[model samples]
Structure formats: C-alpha cells, structure tokens
Target: MTINTTHNCTEPQSNWIFVGVYSMVFMVGLILNLTALVVFFCYTKLWSHTTVYMINLAIADLLLVLTLPLRIYYHLGMHGLSQVLCEGVGLVLLVNMYGSIFLLTCMCFDRCVAVCFPMSCRVREGRKKAPLVCLGVWGLTIGASLPIYISKRSKASKEIQVDRCFGSFPVYATQTTAVASTLTVGFGIPLVVMLVCSWALIHAITRSAVAQTDLINSGKIQRMIATSLVIFLACFLPYHGTLALLYVHREAVPCSLLSVYHYSLMVACLNAILDPLAYYFTTETFRRKVDMDAMTRMFPLNSQNSEGNNSRAPVNT
Candidate 1:
C-alpha cells in the first residue's frame, strides 16, 4: 500500500519554524510540568482518583517535552543522526499527544463521577481503578501507534533523503487507517467524553454548594473545564484536521495545504505548555498556592485521607 508520488513540489521548509516552536514548548512545558510534579509530590498529601490521573498526565507531558531536545537536534540538519533515534522520537511524541488526551479525558470523567454520582459505587471504587486506567491508557496509545511508527519511519531509503527526519516519509494504506482510527478514538471520542463529563461536573457544582459555600470553587471547576476544552480544540483540532486532509488527498498535495499541515504540528505542541492551566484549575495546586483550608474539594476530604495534611483537601464528591 506504499504509494510514492513522483510529481515535484517545493516542500515548504519548517526547520526554523519547528526550532522556534519546539524551543518554546521545551522551556515552558518543562517548567510547568516540573512545578506540577513537585506540587503533587510535596504539597499534596492524599492520592485521590483525580490526583492519580493528573500526576500521570504531568508525567506524560514531561516525557513528551523531554523529547523536544532530540527533535531540535534532528531539525538542526544533523545528517549523521541515527534513524532509529528519529523514529523513536517520533514514536514518543505520538504516544504523548494521544496519551495525554486519554488521561485528560479520564480526569474529566473522574470529576464527573465524583460530583454527579458521589455516592455511587463507581466513585467509591475509582481510587483503586485510576492507576490501572492510567496504565491502560499508556499501553493503548503506544500499541495503537505501532502502525504509524512503521509507516512514518524516516529511515533513509531511496525515496527519502537523509536530511528529512520529521516529514517527507512514506504513507501507507495501513497508516491512513491508523490516522483515521486515531482521529476517531484519540481526539473525537475524548472530545465528546470531556464535554459530557464537564457538563455533568458544572451542573453539579451549580446545583450543590460544591465547596460548602465557597463560590470560588465553582469558578475553579469551570475554569478547569474551560482550559481542557480550549487546549484540546485550539491545539489538537487543527492538527488533526490537517492530518485528515493530508491523508484524504495525500496524493497531489498542494504545497500550500502541506505547509499548513506542517505548521499545525507546531500549534498542536502548545498543549504541553497550556495543559498546566488545567492542572491549576483541577488540582489543589492552585488553591494550595494561596491560603486555603481545604484543597481540590469538590467536596470535603474523606475519612481515609482526612488524617494527614490538615490542609489536604478531599476530591469533590
């Protein structure tokens, strides 16, 4: 199913563009995710379901950001770079982008259950299940990306130039199917899940005295939802949309559209930076930054974690 097109088109250069973009993502994403990790480990005393998800999300973002240095190396016209390294870099980025989305969706779902169905068996049991879910998400995203790894291989072949590591790779029919499936499950379904979970959380917050009369908790919840949706749409939407177009009409691609596709990738990487905004909203990190009696409380802390960190806030329930 590998199809090679012989038509010559001047591929728009993206070396400088990715250089600027990856540098910014590396610096900002590193600082934010690291701060988040410290707060999760040091400041937070309880390991609630939401904390489990957010901590793992931070790790995913951290690992993803870590890959940018190598990306910068490859983009700097290093001809002697190992093709295996390039492929590994590509695989890491792929897993991070989709894995973060899956984890973010889990966060939303956890909140929804905590707020909307606090007394249900699901919420009570979620603490045990959250870690397993995170493991499953990483496993699934990596497994799903195998076909893409095979297709997007940048090894120097007769058709591929040694200078090209990021793009100008072969696209096979299986790769097309992989991309389509990723769009459906990776972005589309997660988008739907977040919206539904967000709606449920917001509705619960408004109806109940979520913080037992702290109106600001409502605002925090709303802001968390807003950040997640905004990041997902503004960052991921265009990247996936352009990918859809590229695959749909991969043959005879106009230079303009292909350029758009390349740049969309830069925009998509912004999630690594902006995602900390969601962390600030959803976790005790923001409230703990200021003087707050209870942290991350959609509800009060439960009996289990209520012992440690007199300030440790219970997840909303």
Candidate 2:
C-alpha cells in the first residue's frame, strides 16, 4: 500500500518545451472554447443535438484549461502553494479530463444512432428521455470524480523529504478507486456503448447506401467517425491501460511500466490538440456554419462574381 514518490520530469528541454507548448495551447483553447460557450448560450434556440453535445464538450475543455495555470505554476517551480491547493487543481483537472472523454463517447453514440436510424432519431427527438440521458451523463461524471476530492490528503514524508497531497489510501483507496471508476465510468461502459452504436451506424449506413445508392454519398461522414474512433483508441486506450496496470501492480511494477506510463501520459495530452480537428470535420453543421466566413476570408463574393462567366459556371463542374 506504500506509494513511492517520483520526481516530475525536470529535464530542461522537456520542462521548457512542455511549458511553452501547453501555454500556447491554453491560450488558444481558452479563446476557442469561450467562443463555443458564446455560441452555445447566445444561440441556444439555433442549437440541435450536435450543438448540445459540443457545448458540453467545450465547457469541459474550458474547465480543464482553467486549471492549467495552477499546473503551469507547479511545473514552473511554484511548489510553495499548500498541498490542498495542489490536490484541488488536480481533482478538477482529472474530472474534466474524464468527463470530456465520456462526453465525447456519448456524442459518438448519439451520432451513431442518428445516422443509423434517422426515423428513430426523430421519434425520440421530443421525448423527455433524451434530455434525461444527457443529465445522467453529467451526474455520472461528477459521481465518478468525487473520489478525488473525498479521499485526497496531504502527508508529510520524512523518507522522501517532501510534504505532498496523495490519495488517502494507496491500497484500497485512491489508486484503486481511480482505476475502478475510470474503467467503469470512463472506459468500460462508454467504450462498449460507443462500439455498439458505431457498429450499428456503420452497418446501417452501408446497407442503406447500397440499397438506395444515392442517399448518403458523403465519405466524409464515415471518415470522420472512423478517424474519431482511431484517435480515441490510440490516445486514450494506452493511457488508461497503463494506468490500470499501474493501479494493479503499483508497488512492484518494473521500470518499463513507468516508461509506458510516461509515454501514454504524453499521448493523452495530444487529445486536446487533436480534438479541434475532430470537431471541425465530424459535424457538417459546423462546416456549413463557417463556410460563409471561410469564403469571405479566402475570396470575396463580389470578386468572384466580377470574374464574369466563370461565376455563372459551377466551380466544380
């Protein structure tokens, strides 16, 4: 049950590089997520199912970014803060991280359902169950992360010559609960749902497309979903898998496990950067929403029209 304290990565290259990269990411993510919030709220009436899921995802991302300052300070050698503050920030960050994963999983399922059975989607549209399901996701996410706040404590270590906050119980407490919760709430349940939904969606789409041959020709949609699943499996699976292994064999794990842990942690951070690409490409609505702006920025309508006969002819044709 005894947990060994490990030093944070302190190589000058890694430290400065992570600091710079995450700082820029924080700034851009903060601005973009804030804009998403504005779109969610100011244009509530204009929202649909995709927007609802995206708004929640953006909120979680925003909260995660908000906690980055404390992490940045810690990484930058501001260890003077009380252990309580450190644990507090860690708790919030963990919640948002897992919450985001689950939310995205939920969104994938929602998309699968909508694509696979449009008629059923419309049938369920006005039902109270739809909103309730979203509410359940939030509630479950909060419940899953509650262990971080509840079991967290600061301990002074004469052996390691450091005072730091850790989970209250290493054996049956913090680490165990975190892994179990993540496996169930963060990984097991959501992944199963996502796979099933996605499978159904793909099957239905393929079948319907072959039958009608003209209904859904957008390979982009399929590509988007496939890309999302690939990224999710690549980035998150390793991280969680490593974490689970660590939780199970924490005391006697080999150095290789620690290496995998570090690598997976780095990959997990890539999720934040990769997500914007996913959002941009997955939702056609998002593309259409920005089309006008993109066109204006790239080439003015008047200028295109002034090109004469070329304007009357279709650009693609």
Candidate 3:
C-alpha cells in the first residue's frame, strides 16, 4: 500500500487552531471526567445499572483525553514519532469515540425502557445485564478499532526522514472500507437508534398523564436525550461527514475542505467536555454529590441561599 502523497499538504493555520482547541479540551475534559470517575467509584451509593454505563463512558473519555497531547505534538509539526505510537493513539481515539457513542445509545435505550415500561418485570431483569452489555460494547469497539493498526503498513521515507502512519494506507480499498464502516457503525446506526429512542421516550412521556414526579422525571430524560443528540450532531456528524467527503475525493480534496475536516475533528473532541453536563443533569447522585455551596462561593453572588437554590433545581435520576 502506498501513501497518498498528493494529499500531504500542511496548513499551519489549521494546525495551530487544532493545538489551541485540543489544549483547552484536554484541560477541561480531563478534570470533568476525572471528577466523574471519582464520584462513580468513591460514592458507592451511586452504583446502579445506569452508573455502569456512565463509568465506562467516563473511562473512555479519560483515555481519549490522555491521547490529546500526543496529537497536539503531532499537529505542531514535531516529527520522528514512531509509527506504532501514532497508530496506537489513533486506535485509542477511535475506540473511545465509538465507545462513547455506543454507551450513550445504550443510555438512551435504557431510559426509554424505564419510561415506557416503568413497572415491567422484564425491565428490572434486564438491568441486571447492564455490566455485560457494557463489556460487550468495549469488546466491540476494540475489535472495530484494531484495524487502524492492521490496515496500514508504515515506512520511513528517505526524503522526509520520518515514518508515516495512516498516511500510507491504500486509499481505494483499505481507506475506503474503513471510512464506510466508520460511517455506518460509528455514526449512522447509532444516530438512527438514538433518534428512535428519543422519539419513543418523548411520545411515552407526552402521551401519559402523570403526576409531578413523573413530569420531572420525563423532563430530565428529555434533557439527557437532547444533550446526547446535540453532541452527536455537533461533534460526530460534521467530522464524519467531512471524513467521508475526504475519503471519496482522496487527493482531489481541497486544502480548505481538509482544514474543515480537521476542525470538525476538534469539535468532536468537545464532546468529552460536554458529557459531564449530561451526567450532572441526568444523575441524581451526581447532582447531590456536587457542592452547591462551594459552587456559589466559587462564583460569588449577593445571595448565597438563592444561588444555591437556583443551582439545585430539580433534575431526574
């Protein structure tokens, strides 16, 4: 397999933008996900079927964030990183990206089932298998991403004196197949499932005439679903969309489109930063774990009680 040397054009402006955005995302995502991990592990009461998925999601995001510095180094024109190291980071990135998607999809389905069949015996039984389901997602994402290392054979170029990683994949076959599979499994299927689940959840909530408790629960579910959908759209959709275009066009893809594709990837990285908000709103334990008084003190206001009350506004578990 040969690299598409024609598409190796560099954009310093875009590279700097990536470095800046990734640095910010790394700092924020790392802190938020680590806090979530602490809450999930230390607060034993927070353990539940849903928290299993949340824990795995946090782990995936944390791992993905840990890879950002390497990517930042790569984008900043630093060379000589081994091909194995490059591909390894790429593998982790894809694994977590799809892993988060699958986990979020599972969450949506879980919430939908809970809302639609609140009293079903089968639903209760199904909750017991949440750990197994998460394990399967991990296995599936790892299996899918392993091809990143397998499909490309890197070689050190005498002219450049550095090894090329994914840049060397055969465009028409391996690259095309990878992009197609990524679009289908990573984005297309998950998007469809999430949309269906969201609609069902909304319908179930709206059609039922329920008490204030149920209303609040429904509102929380809607917020979680909406946040997940927004992240999917804003992050994954544009990145994958541009990715497909780049793959289809190959060397003919313009530098401007390439810049857009790179920026879209950075936007996708923002999902790691936004996911903690979903956790904060959707998980009662997380909300309770938050220090409202500390928050009010950190960002001072005239009236601490009022600010604390506003911060503690009701959210569903």
In order, the Cα lDDT scores of the candidates are 0.71, 0.60, 0.72
The prediction achieving the highest lDDT against the true structure is 3
Angstrom error at residue 143, model 2: 2.2
- Look at candidate 2 and give me any clashing residue pairs: none
By lDDT: ranked, best first = 3, 1, 2
Error of 1 at 187 (Å): 1.2
Clashes of 3: 0
The candidate, 1 or 2, that scores higher on TM-score is: 1
Please name the candidate that would achieve the greatest TM-score relative to the true structure: 3
lDDT of 2 by residue, 1-317 (tens): 22354433122322554466567667877876775565456423455665666777788878877876765665565547665566666667667777778778867777676666567756457432445666777787677666555644423322343333221212222266677877776878877887787677767766774645655664655676678888888878988888788776665654466556645654665566566667733455444333433334457754564343221111110
Candidate 2 ranges beyond 4 A from true positions: 1-14, 121-128, 152-161, 164-174, 210-215, 253-263, 291-317
Cα lDDT, model 3, residue 167: 37
Q: What's the true lDDT of residue 236 in model 3?
A: 86
Q: Against the true structure, what is each candidate's TM-score?
A: 0.80, 0.75, 0.81
Candidate 2's TM-score reads 0.75
| Candidate 2 backbone overlaps, count | 0
Q: Which TM-score value belongs to model 3?
A: 0.81
